[model samples]
Target: MSEKVEDRIKELEERLASTKVNKATQKSINFIKFQLARLREDLIRIASSKKGGGGGFGIKRTGDAQVAFIGFPSVGKSSLLNLLTEGNTHSKVASYDFTTVTAIPGMMNIEEAKVQLIDLPGIILGAAAGKGRGKEVLAAVRSAELVLVILCFRSDGTINLSDLKTIRMELNNAGIRLNTRVPKIVIKERTRGGIHFTYKGHQLMDADEVKSLMNDLKVRNAGVYFSEPDITPDQLIDFIFGNRIYTREFVVINKSDLMKTPISPEKITEAIGHEHWVMISAKNKENINTLRHNIFMELNLIRVFLKPPREEADMDEPIILHRGDTLEKLCRKIHKRFINDYRYSLVWGKSAKHPGQKFDNLDHIIEDGDIISIYLKR
Candidate 1:
């Protein structure tokens, strides 16, 4: 079944590539894309059902977020991990290839928050298809909140663009999408209603074509809401399948000191086509602090202080939260009991209109340096 599905997927992909994508066959193109998506989903389901062994590392998550370092062998992942952890958790570092066999877990402390960092095994050209235990490493990476793609800068001042492309392709094939926003789509099934789509901004596809494609995908009776400015067929397919992992990514160019000629940031950005990149020397600990700061900032974290009813807020020990985290999330993080016991919360920060503003909405978004006091039910 898997083989048949794979062959059909390949055929559909070829058809999509060959077919001219103009107004003459736009609907047909979208239909083909949807068919391909369904077949790929079936392939994944079949593979998961017949799995003999789960081949991935077992690293316990113990921080505000998990960040994985991925690259080819001897790309200085281990050394970077050591630097981030301040030598508290030393991964085996060597000048040779494939020194670290398994995923090594380390803890990085930023303010009062702990970030778990994983140094995964090196991947080769075909890592996504189970090469060099690439599948296992990617499986570990899929669970991370952020991925750090480490690239090597050779001594001759030449960066391997081919290696970077291979790593990106491997991650994409492993269902890990880097630095891509999730489509703001909400599809709700209905018992008795034709497909209705509501969009806030410019529509990418005609309503009739979207309905036809949805019906072809076996979504006959549903209401779809698209909140994005523009949508594409591939984005729609990804949304319906819902197996892709959308997460943040940062590129790290290691061994920058080895380069005889220093490369400008503009040249590096043009070469890599990624704005969020940093060049550093993990061995010499050059720009390690900057990397650490960038990692923390890229995580989009916010610190909220807690205040009692009559007492002052604990300004020193602030509750670490994400940028858009709400009062309900704060309650859950503080204690699971608070989830049901809390009545409302008073806010005094950028999110609130005035100091000590009473807010009953649990979904109100909290901002950085906010002071929140929760009022529980008696």
Candidate 2:
């Protein structure tokens, strides 16, 4: 009976795919999917209930992770999106607030990662408490897997650290204490080093001594570092996401074009104290690829393209899948029923060494560039 219902839902999905469903209908489809997921959750409750009453809407949170762009107005949220996707979307940036009347979203290609970064209205203080456009923006921030807070370059060259605090407060108001939940990475112009660094609010002195300094501060397993300057982005990424640093933000120092009396890589490492920082100009197309790599490593995101049973493959029909998508999540995504009765699935992708490998749907961990065909028990 349950399998029949799943088949019916799949048929409905196919019909919906055939028709031109508007945004509302698409949302309805999501609602239906959510309802089915809720029903699945109610399995235990149903068994326990002697006609038990409480039945309400619930969310089936998937590993379909999302990220949102947030910050004060003219803070380069939209601009960063443009740089990431290379798509010309309207930013409407001004010196003051309220440039965007409606929220805009765009899909960005972070190398192998396909992330959707939504450009939201400028968030102000006290949004969750029902202050200005803060509420609307805060709601968007709450729905993200991670956040990129851009403190951009001004003519004066002083990035507003205070606004960072206020935006954080707004996030908290929206019930997202980003400091605790997600990894926060700060991107800004370099202080003196050509390399990147993280800001830990500590000052270091002496000759090539970060280890001795860590011991002095009693900081154990704080983060990883390269032995020399000019290390590739891969090394930096490994050093960053390799170990958990508790609550951390990947610090990137931008605007290398404007750094006066530039500092060496060692000095760059020291600028943010211990946090890793990357230097780049999104406008100038500088090291943006490296930035993308770091985000993928940090978020543990994987991108996979879906392939059909086949007629003739077209380059136009390749739909890239991203997010924190594991195999288990993919089963739920393809069909909620699959989640309930999933046996296993087979996957092949750019990352997989063995093509057409079978994976236990429950245990398979998805990686970037995986093309998968799920085999379910009919």
Candidate 3:
């Protein structure tokens, strides 16, 4: 398997080098591809950290991702989990504050990534300094790779900048330096907009209208782009999406289905400022899948196909793979490890269309929509 994995890496490197006849032209594309390769190393790190019982205030799940969720009280963190997993949990959520006190970690599948969403206590200003749940707040944010800034938008459908500031300050106090770099937003709707979307107050054509917006907004620091008009949606995203986004979108949005007369998807788009946005009903199950799909898409993550041995009748079924992945990462996850753990494996589909391609290591960088089959050692 090592030999085969090395061969694939060599092939990819060669292709990357050969295709780049001009060093300066394909810089961005090459940079992104390089980051994609680097993610394999990250998978190894995530796998290692999980085995250690999740580093520090962070808790690891039985899978491959180390994602975290943070917001103010009654910001509907648990409710968001219920919507994501449809799994039974506590609380329905409301306009009030201070809902969840303890951390309720939930398993969420975003495309090829198996992510752990940590519903920590609602963070207030000075959380790190031990003021207003500060100690607990800092503890939670200290170990997160991804952060979600959930806000209960003001009565007029505008987000309170101060609330945003509080979450940032609290994280800083907690010792996590998350800024426009590692944050996403979820604005719970208090008003109108259909399941469909609209931009800048105009109605989007379909229920998935938010997808384009998610791609466009990307991520940026309010401090950095405070006075740059050239920082339009696409440029803003390109500038901050990966260099600061960990080869993915550092920003995301949730809570669209809550509106009574919901604003147009376009209005949601303009309101987003400079981060990826998606409307979801953290309480109701409506448009949740849409939100999830947007998450997978905006992050630029590819899904790897998981298949059982050839003897199995259903050999085509696939499980997705993303960053923070490892072979031992989910030992309990494989229906049968001995059966799946062959010394060598084959990869195909989007990444390497030729079937029967071989690989040596399970930790190899997997592209989106990759099909894989493992061969056990004798």
Candidate 4:
């Protein structure tokens, strides 16, 4: 059964590759893609039931946020790991490929934030298909809040574009969506009513097309709503799959010291067609501070201090929380009993309209350097 599913997926993929995508064949192409997604889900289930092949590094995640380094072997992931962390874990640095055989975890403390940095085994071609323990590496990557896709130019100043493309494809095939948010789709199953859908913005797939796709997937009755614009068929399919990981990613060009000729950052960006990038040479420790700063900024974390009523806020010891965390989240983190005995909160920071603003909204989003004073019931 697994073999048959694989064959069908291959055939559908080939057809998709061969077909020219335009208004004329867009529906047909999407239908094929939908079919392929369903078959792939089935294949995963089969693989899981068989056992012996499905496993991960099982690294216990720590720190406020987790960052992963993913790239082909010898792309300087190990050197970057060593430079980022304060000697927590020394990943073996080597000139050859595949130096790091397992997932190495390290702690990075910057901007008063503690982050977990993971240097995973380099991923090779056919990584999504489990080549060279690729499954284990990607499994570790899925847990990361941010992924640094490390790439390097050769000594002759020539970069291999195919390597970047392969890494992107492998991550995609592993259900890792980079630098994208989850599709704003809501699906509610129904017992008797037929499939119904309503979209707020420009609907990419019409009513009939969505109904047909859902029906083919054995979804008989459901009410769907879309809050985002320009939704593609693949996005809808991914929403249905329900196992995809949406994470942030940025490119890291390493080994810049080896470039024989100086390459302009603009030119490199043009060649790679990616705007979010940082150029650094881990071997020479060039631009290491810039990369560290970028990592801290990209993490989007905020330091918030809790002030006891009629007392000064603990400026020295602030709680580390992700940006946009609600006051309710802060209360829960402080203590579960606070939520039950909550009254209101006083805020002093950028998020407040004025200093010492009294707010009763528990869902108020806290900002950086915010000093929140919770007034609990006696």
Candidate 5:
């Protein structure tokens, strides 16, 4: 069965490679891509079933946010982990490859938030297909809120773009989408009706093609809404599979001290085509502060202070919440009964219309540095 799926995937790949991207062939190309995505999803399911679904790294998530370190073996992952956590973690560091064979957990304290940093085993070329603990590593990565791709400079002071590409491909194959947003497509199903697709703006594929794809997926009765103009068939597959993990990612160029000449940030940005790259020598503790700040900023965490009625806000220990978290969620986090006895909430920050604004809307979203005081029924 797997062999047949692989053969079909290869055939589709060949066809897609040879096909031209013109208006006449666009629908055919989209259909081929959709078929390929379905086949890949099937392959992943079969592989997971064969593995007995029991080989993933079983690390409980902790801290305000979780971050994972992923790279090739001996790429200074352990060193970076130690530096990030300030030697609070006990990952095995060595000059040889594959020194750390399991996921090492660490806690990084940035201001009031304690971010959990995980150092997983190195990923190889076929890591996504369950090679050399690749599945376990990716499992850890899926649970993380952020990913740090650590790259080591070559002996000639040049960054290896191939290494970065390999790592990214592995992550992509594992269904972990880094720094990507979920497609703005929503599907609603009814018990007895044909598939209906309603879209706005310019769609990538016509409604008939979308209905055909839905029929292929056995979705006989559904209403598909395409809110985004550029929704692709692969993204539709992703939404259907519903297991793909989307998270933020940043690149770290480790061992910068080994370079004969310092690489400028502009050159690095141009090389990666991303502004999220940071260069640091973990062994020498250089630019560690900058990396920490970047991590905090990318996490989109907001510190909200709590205050009792007629009392000053507790600015010393603020509750950490992700950006766009609602007041109801915050109340539930504070205490389950707070929602039941909720009266109103006073806010003092950017989220408020005016300073110390009072509102009772449970759906009110909180902002960074906001001071919130919850009032409940007496």
Candidate 6:
């Protein structure tokens, strides 16, 4: 199976490289890309089966959030981990390549939220193909709520584009869609009657092509809905595969202090074409505070103080939640019985219309720094 996959990959690579880019070959190109994606998916599944599901490193998730630091060898991941999580479980730091071999977990207390930080082993080229500890590293990354791509300038004072590209490719192959959202497509499987699709916005691909792809995936009876425009074949394939991960990413250009000539933020932005980035010297502890603040904001966390009955709100340690979390979800998080026993909740915060506004809707979205008191039947 591996040999067949390699042969097909080679064939597709050759065809893709030699094919002309014109309207006549657009559909053919799209189909080739889809086939390549499917083949890669097969390769990953085969590899995982061989390794067994529980072979890789596993860490019980703790804290308000989990963020992973991923980069090449000697990219200051360990240094950053130690700096961000001072006096906690410190990752080993040495002036050597691959100093860290496994995932090192640490806790960073930003404001009142305790964030779990993992320093993963460095990823090398061909990591997606099991080079270095790529499989383990990617598995760790998959479990992270956020990914911080740490990059460093080479001795020649040049940003390594090839390294960045390789890391990005490995992540892509692992089904980790960085800085991307889940496509607004819903699939409802039916018992029979074949495949049916209802598209509201403008379609990017031919309807017949979509139907053909759906049939290839063996979606014999299903209803597909596309709510957004410019949906591509790859997105459709991702939906069908159902294992793809979509998460936010923030880039960190480390070792900025070591550069002989200072590199401007504008140049870095131009090179990466990504707006969300921070420059920090983890070793020197420069801009580490700013980076912590940035991380807290990027996580989209909100603090809600729980007020019980006649007692005042516990402002010291508020319940942390993500943005857009509703009151019903909060109730479920607190306890399953709260849902049935829920009467009405009084709120005071930015989300409320006035001070101590009463709301019976469990679906009311929560806001940061909101104080709420839950009332139940006596």
lDDT for each residue of candidate 1 in 35-130, tens digit (9 for 90 to 100)? 876765554444333333222675677788889999999989999999999989999999898999988999999877789999988899866555
Q: Sorted on TM-score, highest at the top, how do the candidates line up?
A: 6, 4, 5, 1, 3, 2
Against the hidden true structure, what lDDT does model 3 obtain?
0.50
Candidate 4 on 294-351: residue-level lDDT in tens? 9888889899998999998899888888888999989888899889999999999999
Tens digit per residue, CA lDDT, model 6, 1-378: 666875786688689889998757767777787787787777666654544442146666788888988999998999999889986777898988999998898999998999999898899986765678876787778778788989976777766656777788888877788888889999898999777878987897666666767777777788888889989888988877888878777888888767788777788788777888888887678899999999999899889999887898898988888999999977887887788889999999999999889988799998999999988765
- What tens digits encode model 2's per-residue C-alpha lDDT throughout 251-297? 44445455455557776456444444466676577888887776566
- Whole-model lDDT, candidate 4? 0.84
For all candidates in order, the CA lDDT equals 0.83, 0.51, 0.50, 0.84, 0.84, 0.82
> For residues 70-164, what per-residue lDDT tens digits would candidate 5 score against the true structure?
99998899988888898788798898889989888899999799899999899898676557877678767877889999998777887765788
Candidate 3 vs. true structure, TM-score: 0.53
Q: Whose lDDT is higher: candidate 2's or candidate 3's?
A: 2
Cα lDDT for residue 166, candidate 5: 88
Quote the positional error of residue 16 for candidate 4 in Å.
Answer: 2.9
Cα lDDT over the full model 6: 0.82
Q: Which stretches of candidate 5 lie over 4 Å from their true place?
A: 1-55, 190-193
- The better-scoring model by TM-score among 1 and 3 is 1
